[model samples]
Target: MPTKPSVLFVCVHNAGRSQMAAAFLAHLAGDRVEVRSAGSAPADQVNPAVVEAMGEAGIDLAHARPKVLTTDAVHASDVVVTMGCGDACPVFPGKRYLDWSLADPAGQDVRGVRPIRDEIERHVRDLLTELGVETEGVETGGVETETEPRA
Candidate 1:
């Protein structure tokens, strides 16, 4: 890893799972890790239910927008995490790649998106552990546990 490891989160829409994962990683890792998120087919806006779910965790995604996946992004990242983007994501050798089998949160309500948000949190926590980044005041399996929020 570089002095600061960079991670890219990719999904099909970049509107839900990838957005949530990026937000969680950014919140937990702070500036210790560089976080980026993109979609295979970018959407116009973030999924509203995902935004609400993240807000429930005390993190905001209200202004988050979808980003396009690019080979340059994959090349720049030390770790590339794919959430159901499959072939849409570019593969480059020598980069750590992880594919998270997460449910799409596009059309779900806050009730349905909560679990997915929690699952992404868990995975992001695990990834932080693997990257040797320590988070403060974040509790696993609890939606309300938090510290300061970040964008």
Candidate 2:
């Protein structure tokens, strides 16, 4: 089989937006893509509201943790998506980079996080299509095993 396309999502804190985006990508793309997420400045844990939001979509993110961004991660990925990470994420030639200006779910409740989660799902779906992966009726599940929460 051909190698799977890899994506890395980065944000200031891996606590909210990035976490949701990463989870959604994995849930939608399954094992067809290599999903990874990290923070420019790692947090102790993922934001509680983010965990709850993902649970609503049937993906458990309670076991996920924040990871510090690294050059290796940027090098390994075919795409590097930034979410409010600014200049923290190094830019490399030949890598597809996208900056998603998503609202931070840091202090928001589950209700407030829902919209952010939905937006992320839409972005993830579009991304899968850009990668040439079919999303028409793919079975959805947590792609956590293939993703390293602390990468």
Candidate 3:
């Protein structure tokens, strides 16, 4: 049997974007992928608005806490995704690195967080595809469609 690919999501706080990305990857990829998340400077807890937004997507992050980034984490992961963490993450030779430019959801309300959550989901789905993981049985919890403004 082939070993599962591991992915690490990193950000400055790990309270919002990284948490959401990790949850989406775990939920979507099931056991096919190993998901981890951390921050350069750890926060006390996951962002509440991020949790609520994820709840709307049917992923519970209520118990998730911010974790400090470590070199071991980067070494263990096949892919390392950074969300505005800048130079905080340690680079490894064999790891694939991706930087996602996303809005911080720290003080954002649920409404503000929803879009960021959805965007993370999209990126996670794309990553799954790249990793040769199928998302067929996963429930996406429905991303809201934007209506075009009539001129």
- 1 or 2: which has the higher lDDT? 1
Q: Roughly what TM-score does model 2 have, to 2 decimal places?
A: 0.89
Write the residue-wise lDDT of candidate 3 on 30-139 in tens digits. Answer: 99999999999999999999888888788899999999999999999999999999877888788899999999998998878888888888899999999999889788
Weakest 10 consecutive residues, lDDT, candidate 2? Answer: 142-151
Q: Which stretches of candidate 1 lie over 4 Å from their true place?
A: 138-151
* C-alpha local distance difference test of each model: 0.88, 0.85, 0.89
Best by TM-score: 3
Worst 10 residues of 3 by lDDT: 142-151
**Residue 75 of candidate 2: its Cα lDDT?**
98
lDDT of 2 by residue, 54-130 (tens): 88677789999999999999999999999999988899999999999888898988877877777787788889989
Candidate 2 stretches greater than 4 Å from native: 139-151
TM per prediction: 0.90, 0.89, 0.94
| Sequence-dependent TM-score of model 3 | 0.94
